[model samples]
Target chain A: MKTIWFHLMPYPELPDDFTDEHRSVWVDIDPALFDARVGHRMYNEYIDELEFAASVGFDGVGINEHHSNAYGLMPSPNLIAAALARTCPDAALVVLGDSVALYNPPIRVAEEFAMLDCISGGRLVAGFPVGTPMDTLYAYGNNPATLRERYHEGIELILKAWTADDVFSFNGKYSKLRYVNCWPRPAQKPHPPIWIPGGGSVDTWEWCARVGYSYLYLSYFGYKAALKTMQGFWKCVEDAGRPANPFQAGFAQFFGVADSEAEAIELYREPAEYFFNRCLHVYPGFADPPGYKTLNTVRNGAEGMVERAAREANERAAQAAKKAERKAAQQSFSAASHMSFEQMVEKGYVIVGNPDQVAEKTVEMAKQLRIGHVMSLCHFGNMSRDLAMHNTELMATKVLPQIRHLWDDEWEDEWWPQPLPASDRVMPSPRPTVSR
Target chain B: MIDLAQWKAGSLEIWREGEGRTVGYLHGMVCAPGRQPFVTELASRGFEVVAPSLPGYSRTAPSDDIRNIHDWVFALSEIIDVAGLAGAPMVASSTGAMLALELAAVRPEAFSSLVLVAPLGLWRDDLPVADPFSTTLSGQRALLTKDPTTTALFFEDHESGDALVDATIQRYTARTATASLVWPLPEFGLSQRIHRVSCPVTLVWGSDDQIIDPSYADSFAACLRDVRGRHVVNGAGHLAEWDDPSAVASIAASALN
Candidate 1:
């Protein structure tokens, strides 16, 4: 099995009374709360952790996009991925990805991604996400009615721009380029392996299946809750008559492995609580706009639609229920946040315990879902840099080596990043290693 | 009566009433209010009103041919042409008025005159219009009308079975089509082309209209080359006709005459 370390890079110093004092942590979040000086240090610390994970023998290190939110500070994942490409040579510099729809011409994405692949010596995993409506529709000013249409159009334009051999005049519904030429074609022939990060939309599932791309579901809502979606994707693959190669799917989970269960709980409990309770306190209204969800998705009661359907139920009870949930952090933290250490472990929201326990639970999770890639989120919320470093080393030394051989003999990973041929590879200066 | 008009790949619902000189009626962000008391009053005033579904709205499945604002103008112009209102005086409300303003600007030969009510086309930085796309039901209801009771003219609840799905799809698709025009912001540069509208234009707004403020009435009038004057109906909101049927219908009657 291929395991990667994904970082969300959350801002952890929010006031204790954040739930009461703040309306939300996204889109309309108070800019006054963010300090540039603190951000400078936090960013460096985050990049260091990602590089550290790559150097310590993890197969890959990942980063993703979020916008106008404190939950994930990296709005532009490309900027961070470029820095990672320069610093970390060996690991898959998984840009778990850019919201391809946000770019105007979207060829800009093709251009930038091509440059990143070249810089990384062909070690880029292009992640195309439709993006949350909060980022795409409201924050980015995309019309929700035509959001998907524009997104599909953007993807079409990008794929064509990347692989087209000749410069041609292209006319798209959203973008029109008189001379279509993508300078500096990708290092990987055709393009980098496309990974789609979705929130369980059936359209996204069938799309990824049909296109032979990996559907990486990154959820703060742990593996137990995520089972519904994982099953849905597996079903799509089965229905499509495609092989259920574990490499075709990836799932992200929070973890803290230690020498003992007590030590693991003590180390991870705070950050786990912080991520679920504070980082995820987005305003319900900002998450969905009119026509943001497709009618099919809405009818099917997909992951994103439940919140919208509840808010728009036209019943006073439903409105009050939504309002109550939004206002009270305690209500959600207990039910889904699983803040208590035992609850977190029981729910499989966070795999925190001794190395044996962590590895056992993680392997079981992968085998049950038939997920080939397990994306571990080791650094989350506001764990101190020193502790984050310790967590990375422990997970690398004690946990990863134990489970790296699970599915290797049976299934080939076609979705993993292909290393450049030795002649073209530009290896970064190897970081001095701590004894493995 | 409301009936489906199948043409090409799109199926449009056309509502026609009364008998006389045809009035090319344009609906706003909401579905056709059917033969509501306001539409009924307008019909009783002796005029055949033709309100066809805008492209990709109501029962009219969206077409690939219609993409942007210009595409919308072209498709709507085709509908107007097919309805045989080649040079009819038009009555349009809310976003419908926004489209009518564009059409009249593009092809002034097709429209004889225009009565735009609570039209939302002009952008105001200081007096930014309330966005209906993101708001909840109650919040949207508040912005659109002063009295929630007036919303009965738009939302016919207590629907059962087939009628229930029909009502839900009606509201869902209406907003979907509306967001294509007014979302993010209602500023599609109609101000730059409002001067090109050759026909005499009358702007009517509700005094208490919360959606598109009444102050925008003058802002829209300021950009037009020709103006037949502006009127504000008391005790009305953005859907001024629904709130004050008599006042809006009377003003529209005078403008059309």
Candidate 2:
């Protein structure tokens, strides 16, 4: 299995009463709450952590994009990827990735990604995600009804820009460029490997299966909850009659590893609680705009229809039950926020244990799901620089070695980046390692 | 009696009633006009009513061709022509009124006159329009109408035989069309084109409208080339026609005559 270290780079210092007083952590989050001085230090600290993860011999280091959000601070993952490309030469620069539709002309992505691949010497895993509803629809002001359409068109335009030998005049519904040519074409042949980080959209699953791109399910609720979505993707692959190469899939999970289970719990409890509570405290109003969810996702099946019909017959009781149901559904994240650290562990929202235990759980999850890539989120909400280093180093020294050889003997990883030979590469100056 | 029929090769769902002079009706963000009391009242006033559901807002599925405000204006103009309501005095409400004005701005003679009820094509920095798409479903209902009865009758899921799935799809379809037109903000450069509407226009609003404030009646009246007058129906919200059907229909009928 290929283990990639991912960072969300959340703001570490929210007020103690932030959840009590604030309406949301995104979209309409209070601007006054953010301090630029703190952000400056935090950014460098985060970049340092990503470098540290790479230094500890992790196969890859990753970043992603989010807009108008406190957590996942890289609004432009490419900028951070550029920084990593120069310094972390051995580690794959995984940008899990740009929200393609947000760019005007979207060739900006093609240009920028190509530049990163060149700078990193052909080590770039380009992630194309249909952005979260909050980022794309609300913050970026893309119409929900046409967002997916624009996104699909944007991806087509980008892929064509990357590979077309001759300059082409493209007339698309959302964007039209008369002269289309991407300068400084990607270092990797036919562009970097495309990994789609998705949220269980059936259309995305089918598209990934058909296109032979890696489908990465970013698990917020952890591996147990991720079972259905991962199963759904494998089903799509099976139906498409494609090989069930584990490398075709990747899954993200939050991890907290230590010398002992109790130590792991103690170290990770605050950050885990902070992440589930505040970072995920998104306003329900900003979620799932009108056409953000497709009709297939919205419509209840025939059995559900019959059930709904019966429920409609007993209107008052049904309404009362529905109100309760809606409340529970809306509060699902908040419910996680309020959960004790023990509850989060039991639910598998966060995997916390000694190295052997953590490795065992990870291996069990990867094997069960037929996953070749395990994206480890070792640094999360409000975790200090020293503690984060401890988590990453322990995972690297003890945990990764145990799981790294899982799918290697049986399946080849065709999706990973193929960097140029080290002898031919331009090297940066080696910095003295920081002692924690 | 109102009849439901399909137009444009079964791609448009239209409601038609009465048998005299044609009065083209355009519906707002929520329900189709097939069973609205205002459409019934307008028909009883001795004029033919042709109400075509805006694409994706009713039984008609969303068309890929109609993607933006410009396409919407073109589509509405086509509907007006195909429904045989060209040069007829038009009655439009909310999101439909927004499209009606956009069409009139460019086509001019598309409608003989227009009685627009709380249209949502203008924005003010100080009094920004309340966004229905950015709020909860209950919050959207509250913004649409002031009366709980109207909310229950139209917005709530209380009908006996209707499947919840169908109702949910209906609501989502309506929202998709409406959001496509007016989401983020309703302003689609209508302020720049409002002066080009050659036909006379009568603006009406609910006194208690929250979506686009009733005060915006002045904003529209100020820019329109030929404004007959502006009327505010008391004890109503954005969907004034639903709250006080007789008052809204009477105002619309009087304006058209």
Candidate 3:
């Protein structure tokens, strides 16, 4: 199993009364609340953390994009990826990733990803996300009805730009280009390993399966809640007649480990609360826009194909009752914002224990979910640098070694990044001292 | 209630009744044209009311070609011509009023006269239009009218009990159509083109309109080429026709006459 240290890089200085006073944490989040000097310090500290994670034997280091958001400071993950490509020499540069539909032409993504792959010596895992409603529809003002269409077209355009041998002319509904040629081709022959980080959209699952891309379920809710979505994805993979390779899927989980169970809880409780309560306190209005979810999703149960199939198994009279229960279960993540820490623990929102125990539980959950990759968010919310480092060091030194040998012998891990050896890697010459 | 009338662009569910001169009606942001009480009131007031549910507002499938405001204007103009109410006196409301004015600006003789209620074609940075799409359904109901109860026609389950999904899709398609034209902000440069409308326009506003301020009436009046009159009905909100259909019908009848 491969582990990636993922950071949301949230602002740490929101006042105690932020959730009460502000209407939302995104889109129309107050500009006055963000302090530039603090941001400058946070950016440097966050990058240092990612670099530290890479040095400590983590397989990959990751960052993501979010716009007009207080929780995620990264509006451009590519900039962070560029910085990491030079600094984190031993780690995969995972940008999980750019919202392709948000770009005007979307060739911007192809060019940038190719550039990152080249700079990182082919250790790049490209992530394409359709994006949240707040980021895509409200903040960027993309049409909700047409966002998915643009995303589909944008991916098509980007793939052709990367793989096509000759320059081509492209005509599309959302974008048109007279000349379509990417200057710096990716170091990876076909393209970088494509990972789609998605929410529970049925169409997204089927698309990822059909195209042979690894599906990364980036959910805040823990493995228990994620089981349903991952099950639906595996069903799609089965229906597509593809090999049920564990490496074809990835799951993100927030974990806290220490010397003892009590110590782990004490250390992680505040940051966990901060993340669930304050960071996730988005306005309900920004959650779902008209046409954001497809008509098919609306017609089927909100949980998508799995729920529909489950409903069909039950007697017709009992389906409605089961649906009402499912609806409450879906709200469990948002309800975490108001829940007690013990409640969160019992419900599996965050996995907390000693290093050995955490390792044991993680392996168990990974096997049950049939996934090989874990994007571990060890540092979350307003967790301090010292605490974050301790957590990372513990997870790297003790936990990772225990889980490392899980699927290595049974199946080939094909989705991991393949970096060029140091002998073949290119390094720019140092700048010469200027003479007067 | 008449079945949907087919046109070149798509099928439109229309409300057509009564006899005498034709009076075309276009609905506001809340519901389709026929769903509102004013359509029936106007039809009963001794005139033929030709009110077609704009494309995507009813069961008719939205065309992929209709992507922007220009396409909306062209499609709406074509609907009026196909429905055979091209030269009739028209009464339009809110979002419909915005489209009607756009059509009138480009094709002067499309309507003999126009009665526009709380049209949404202008923007004031300080007095911004309340975003109907960004709030809860109940909150949106409160913005659309002074009394939230009047919005049951929009939120209440349809008569077909098992067709809940179908009703949700209807509302979503209607919202998609409106948001395509008015989202982020409702202004689409109609202030610059208001001078081109040759037909006489009578403006109406709900005194308590929260979506677009009642004061915006003066803003529209200042730019229009020919403003016959401006009237504000008392005890009403943004969808004034829903609040007091009799008063809106009476005002519209007087304007048409």
Error of 2 at A152 (Å): 0.9
Summarize candidate 1's per-residue lDDT along B1-257 as a digit string, tens digits.
88777666568778898888889778777544455667777888998888777765667776656556887788778878876676998888998898888888888887899999988888888899987756566667777777767776455577877777666666666767777888788878888888889998999999998888899988987888888979999989888887888888899888898
Q: Which stretches of candidate 1 lie over 4 Å from their true place?
A: A305-346, A429-436, B31-33, B152-170
Prediction 2 global C-alpha lDDT: 0.84
* TM-score for all models, in order of appearance: 0.91, 0.92, 0.92
Candidate 2 deviant stretches above 4 angstroms = A300-337, A429-436, B1-10, B151-154, B158-163
Model 2, A167-211: lDDT tens per residue?
998899999999999998998888999999987677787889988
Q: Model 3 Cα displacement at A432 (Å)?
A: 8.5
Ranking by DockQ: 2, 1, 3
Say which candidate scores most in DockQ. 2
Error of 2 at B247 (Å): 1.5
Fnat of each prediction? 0.67, 0.76, 0.49
* lDDT by residue (tens digit), candidate 3, A348-410: 778999989999989988998889889999888889988999999999999999998888888
